[model samples]
Target: MSQTSNSSSRLSALLLAAMACAVSPAVVSAQSADSATAPGLPATPTPNATINLIRLMVERGLLPAADAAKLVEQAETEATQARAAITAAAQPAPVAPPPLEPDTVRVTYIPANVKRQMIEEIRSDVMAEAVAENWAAPRTFPEWVAKYKFFGDVRFRYEGDFYPDGGVPGGTIDFNRINTAAPVDYFSSTSTAQPPSYNADQTRERFRFRARLGSEIDLADNFTSGLRIATGESSSPVSQNQSFGASGGNFSKYALWLDRVFLKYEIQPKAGSSFSAIIGRTENPFFATSMIWSNDLGFDGLVLQGKRKVGENLTPFFTLGALPVFNTSLNFGTDSTASSGGGKAYASQDKWLYAAQTGVIWNINNDLTLKAAIALYEFQNVEGEVSAPIDATTLNTTSGFIGSTDSSRPGFAQKGNTYIALRELTNSTLPGAGNFQYFGLATPFRELAATARLDYNHFEPFQVSLIGEVVTNLAFNSGDIASNGPTQLPGPRNNNSFSGDYEGGNVGWNVNLQVGAVALQKAWDWTAGLGYRYVESDAVVDGFADSDFGGGGTNLQGYTVSGNLALSQNVWMGVRWMSANSIAGDTFKADVLQIDLNAKF
Candidate 1:
């Protein structure tokens, strides 16, 4: 056994010597290549050299294949230790004064192999410490995923409404009455005639919540795509709040709707100047107050915007866009056996909105700035035309009046537009069919608006601003609206005119003053503002106006006060109150209050 052991030891020594000769030149070549490639990169072991050493060992019977692998691993480890030691020693050591005696000399020495072993020991200790501390390599993400960004906000609110005892009044119930004539009562019982009365005094309160999630993806260069999903009823284009008990019955999940999906590309002609074009269902592109368009309204179309810096403080911008409001196709041609044979058939023309705005921003020194803009919004095919009814089947059976059987209209009833039915004297051939009603729009809308804002920023951590806006409908004409309906009233056995008291008004305006932090930041940051507004029924499309004013849109005059306080960097509390009354045709009044807790991430 002793003789065998000695022989094995000799064989191991021979294997080590052979491996050294085979690996030395390859290691030097690797070092040379590494030096040429980059700084601080260690030389890599040559697999061919190591394999040759291992083959020689196995062929000569110096070691088994497995043992040869172990031997090669051990040699590589030693070489790594040697390299590390040499690299460390190459660093310049701290300078020390010469020995006090001029003839005296100092010397320190460390054996090359011993120094290399010490380095290996130190490296082993460092690796063990790292493992004990759970150190790990950083995680890696794919290139596309790295380009994505996410954002969202959550809001919880308490809303209140107050209505006076007088209730809403002034709208005429008699379809055949003109503006100059006395109006009929709308709330009277069928058997008894009573004066028109307002709704009784009432107060309502509810809790509501809104949430939105959005993501932006960097497609390439200056192009980006964005998507946002929000919680709300699909029917409302201006609100995302989900009121408690909105489901009508037991607890139900809130509805999720796509709020924005758009693509944007930015062009830079020079420093500090840019132009962008956006398309799809996107955020509002025009700079205007809620008097003309609600802040939450999204435009489904395309927008072009440009900004140019003139000198150092004067910058001008402009925006242009076109949006499709409604689309429909109908078959209104005559057919004898058709469902509406000689009856009214519904048809609608496509509606579109085109808008253009230009504005300038001026910086007057460091503490003050002024901004102003003018815009024009025009609508095409918004007016409707009613076909003459050939028989009684075309008339509204419930009211014995002409009404639209077509589902498509420029706007919904909840939007506060007055819908009139055009009719002509026609006798019913059928026994029970009443006189035909042909419902259509009696008014057309076109608006020109101007707005101005002044900002003073002298107060640190606080901001002060004043804003004003005015809008007028160029297409409004009382005579035209009054003349659109039937010229003569149908016989109710009494005298009545076909035109109700709908005299179109053309002006709307709002003014506001605000003092607060521009945005909520850390805890205790706050803001407050007050404003007054008067919106004529015809100045703007009530359907797209601010819904919170006058319980939901146009022909409203009011005052609003709002305040907000931040709870944290990304959370805030807000309160708002609005008291409003109708501008015309109605004596409606309302008070709205909202308390909100909001958070963003």
Candidate 2:
């Protein structure tokens, strides 16, 4: 209908133009006058262009105004029909196309430099945030939520011991050994000049305190670094203040030492395994609570540990690594001159100690587990200075004849005239006192250890556990011997007074009881246990005369009673008492009490 209207309008415009030109002035007037009588057609023409045709006709005396209007309307109607037909013919044909929606497009790219700049900006923003909060970057945080964390342990202690004296009474003077070939003033002490007696006045009062501070940083998803400052024999160089001398003086010196500083790599296992790699100083993986014969103590090495599940109930573990052993020295004199024998006067041997080990762990059941391990440790060789004989009648004054021994060689004989031999001694023919001497090698001394541990736990109302442990020195088993030098018995062994071999085995055992949730469960969760240890060592001292020196054995047996009380999940306290018996018939005892608190942020 709309199309028809548009067509009709066009036709009317054409017709109007044509008619205005075609009609004469007189004819238009006559036609308009006859319109009323002959309505179908205009009767005459008139010059009506100046006005609308109807009005012009009326004024020209052609017809009445009303009849002229009617004729004009009829002409307009016919013209409308004609225009409709012509317009319809002139319209363009519509074209068909597949249906679709127009799509809008956008493009974007980030150049390398711009991307880097944006990253730097983000980092700066993050750094600012960290500083405002007194926090660290993501790499420094121990956990996802913590950018950085501070952790430390402080142990305040009041300790006491039975033997207030500096050392166990009646114990043999073994300082004849010195790590250095020459004397070191820094390592020597006054104790070596004169042998101290077991006088009550020399005993010491015991008091002690220890602390540790540490932090961890996460460098990446699998990498982390941790450092700790600790005070204690196990962690640091500070010896515990077990007692005070009778003179009312501290017997042990306290100092700070770095316990641990290392980077750890945690490898995410594929499905059911665990792996860890550590670089720098770390603890040796061994079963014995005490590192009786392993060199994996302190810094300077790398370690690898891995755990894999072989079966449903069996998980095997292994550790491999090398560590450097630090030698300890004691001085006997206040002067630069090294002492012939006794405590206090030597320096640690300058050499690198090497070690390596591998081990496996198996779970027999929920209540039983077992571990087997083997290790190789290399210790630096220790050499001592030799002294000449003092006189023939007074015995060797320089050798400080603490005991006496006999040798086949004339020089091995004592200088004393008619000297009475109090004790019989066993002498080894092996050279260098069977010290496994490899003097030519850059690093000569080493000791290997093999250990096995079996543990059992019974879960009833209370948790009860039993652990049995054993260790053996592989160096002894090898039967390697240094050259048995000149049989000079009365004099120091081959210019080395401290020549000797370390041979021994250790056994340790422990029984643990975890107090069940009994009447005290509401207030205290506790565990009480007892542990026992035994060490047997055979020490051989060569070059002493039968009248002055001898080699003997030392055995130590000790027991520890410990109790643990958990005030709460985050708070706990522990107490322990340890007592030991030396082969020399000396008894020593120590007691420790500790309190600890832990919290989560």
Candidate 3:
């Protein structure tokens, strides 16, 4: 049915071919020749669309102009007959039915091969637009922006502190305050002032909350960066729970602190396991429990970490780090060693902690696994330094006042660690001569620790795990601590001196058994566990240990029981109870209860 066209109609044929080729591959314009398409879309099943389809075949030289014209004519006739058939099927025609529809996709010049190719091209275009305007996680953003991911969590807790009924009220020394702020005057004959007292044997309750927001960005290489901010009542490194409004006013806004900022890089060798390095403040690089490193503590400085896969069921890992504990002040002796212009210069006494750990993960079978590690952490220049004897008669005429090693004093400390005074006053005659003073840790801290965990999943959806860790402070020596200046224990001080007995110990350990759902996910799924702990006076630095057991610190013995229930995805609630008592100091004990609601993204 092809009629050859002469030169007279060749102009028309060329024009039709040009228009058909110029149309977008995805869309036939909504304003096609007769505007034969659905509202707001350029799709298939339209008269002009059919004609364009035939002309495109001619333009691609798949069919001649005459044959394309013949096809178009036949397609129009079929469409007209199809409409008449539809009208007759309905006893009384409503009105002229819409010929073009968003749902109709059939091409009138339908041949099997051509229809398949045309459908593929149009589907490709539709998919591109759908992804760009996707309802969830739109993909139209820049490639670099797509590499970023954000996550965070918020927790609200109600904590109750119950003190023993028979305990006394005010003998505990508030050394933490003295170390960070001012010291009590002890040298003046007329001065009856004493160190600030801690709140011992007091029952209390408070509402606290912890909030954190962070972002992780993946760079082009195998490098990544993380940044986070959190709420904290103070600048303490081990606690991030900000208390609810208890100030003079109600509903006060709180402060946010920089909690984590770090850069990490990793590389997978072509034939071996992966290796990595991290810098700045980030999560602790070593695997440890709260008895060794608190859940909220962040490690700062440089750390190197690696894991080697030995076999299908065995992997060995190691970590090493050097961290700065304290940096010396520039103008440390200004007041005591003052001149007409400014304070005197002092020697630098910075402190550092060097740590290392090696461990392995052993998967014995489908139902059992074991993980174990041994670690060493040594604190350098962390011991207290006593100042030179001061001459009583020359109090006002001294050229230098502060000690050379005063900067070695810990800017922050917790309970259970033995301490000594930094000043060695020679019976000053002046009034209030001991107004400025400081204290330092009596023992250098070098902890050696061994830990292990065994997990069994014999019960289908539940797991049974046995966990244990033992730690000893290798540097803690009662003789060395007592030989220094007057000692300060956790409780009351006796005549500002040591009792001459072995007053402190170096070892601590904890073990726990748990049974519950492997992980929290759906409603009513629950988990419960119980554990016991015993920490000697100097076993581990109390500053970085768990803050919830016995009001936070060491020289404590305790047992903990906890239970959690999942309410929905990314949300859960937990209840915990801890009963703790002092291991061997003045009588002290407490029972703590905490109920928490947590959510994460």
Candidate 4:
């Protein structure tokens, strides 16, 4: 046998002998004798293998140390003798040896400490490779998996909507539907479409749910990509909630819509100074309240934002972005439909929004901080155009007006914006009573807004904050809209002419005060806030404003009281109440109550 092989056999024999001592001597003799020649034997046992049984017996008062030593020596002697005897029996040549007395072999007990030391050396010799190869610890995934993160949130809500008892018959006109949806042929004798309107005096209650799941991946350098999906009905930009028992709901499955997909790259030149660029359908880029942009609103476009630290406790920031509000179809006005106005092709009327904002964060003292910002939002090609005069003598108003400027009508709306007919028809050709026509926004929209917030965090877990904002529609021109005349009204108009009601304003403002935890994160964390808002007609785009205010959209004034309490980590419940009335248009009043349970991970 090789030297290494011989040594291994000896070490294995020692380990096996010690193991068999716990059994009987006869078993020790047979097992230990065969271990030395066994194929595929285990690696050397731990050092304790030599004296573990003996020490265990000693600790348990089952055997004295001296007696254990003697038993070990006796086991080793018998095992060796059996191996020798078996070898001799295998020899072909005749060889006889006098046997020892009655299968007895003399024994010399080796001290337990000495045996342990010897076995420990053998263990180190054989286990060296395993330790070097990291055999004891292993991993489950590639290192790249560490760069990805996942998140999600779910909300369940119960809400009630109440309106005043008194109002003009037929209630308030659902102008949002009138402006957003294609104008129907309400005038035709066989028309199936009716003028849509809201239930002004009715009370409504509903259950709704919202769910979202998202993931983010970190790429090389400072680049990141993210994706998210959410549940909603019709995928409204201002809401992610899907009402229960709607749209053929009989325990029907819900649909998930792509809510966010964005790529971003960022760089930090120094402490508190950084810049970033983001693109795709993403969260809003500007820091603004729901008065200007709803909490659930997402932006589709590109933005570049940066911030620079100027001296201690002061940082200035700026943002620039371009967003496509709506894209005109390639053939919006090429067909001989009512909207096409006698098959004449029209120019592109794609709507877009360009914005620029500057803001600053300043630390007034150890306990107080301030944030302020000013932003200008400009809309391009978003104004309506009165169509060319029609030939009155040979006139025929199609099902709905489809003129060159029809595409300027908003793709979505929430009411309260002034409106004018897109087609110009003379008195002789004007639609008779019961005939219908479509309308577009009366004035263009360009917003200039200023906002400020102050926070006192001296209370640590409890903080106090004041937030305020004021905005003006710089593009509003009442005189020009009036000159167009014959504006759309809320109810039936006996004459096809202006109602002499401009019903428009250019300014809006809001103020809010908050107390308690800045954010709800864990059990016992809570927050309470009270706020008031006034939005004049045409002050802000009704489609993107706070969807829960005055049944949604501008031309409203209201007070909101809300509170949130975290019931557990990553779980919270909230309650809010809003009471509002119209600033113009139809006379209306509403009260909304909402309770929500929210969870995130």
Residue 520 error, candidate 1, Å: 0.7
Clash pairs, candidate 3, are none
lDDT by residue (410-508, candidate 4, tens digit) is: 777776666666644444334442324456677788999999999999999799999999999999887777766232223222111235455678899
Model 1 alpha-carbon drift over 4 Å, by segment: 1-140, 169-201, 329-348, 394-408, 413-416, 422-425, 428-431, 435-441, 487-503
lDDT of all predictions: 0.68, 0.42, 0.75, 0.76
Candidate 3's C-alpha runs over 4 A off are 1-116, 128-140, 186-189, 246-249, 270-272, 338-342, 391-403, 429-436, 486-502
Q: Please provide TM-scores, in order, for all candidate models, with all chains considered together.
A: 0.68, 0.49, 0.76, 0.73
Task: State candidate 4's TM-score.
Answer: 0.73
TM-score of 1: 0.68
Query: Which candidate number would show the highest TM-score if scored against the true structure?
Result: 3
Candidate 2 structure quality by residue, lDDT tens digits, 206-262: 455556677787787798888876654433121321222322345656545677788
Alpha carbon lDDT of residue 545, candidate 4?
A: 92
- What local lDDT score does residue 358 receive in model 2, on the 0 to 100 scale? 65
Q: Which residue pairs overlap in candidate 1's backbone?
A: 166-198, 167-198, 167-199, 176-497, 402-437, 403-437
Using lDDT as the measure, the top candidate is 4
Better of 1 and 4 by TM-score: 4
Error of 1 at 484 (Å): 1.0
At residue 483, give the lDDT of candidate 1. Answer: 54
Ranking by lDDT, best first?
Answer: 4, 3, 1, 2
The candidate 4 region of ten consecutive residues with least summed lDDT is: 488-497
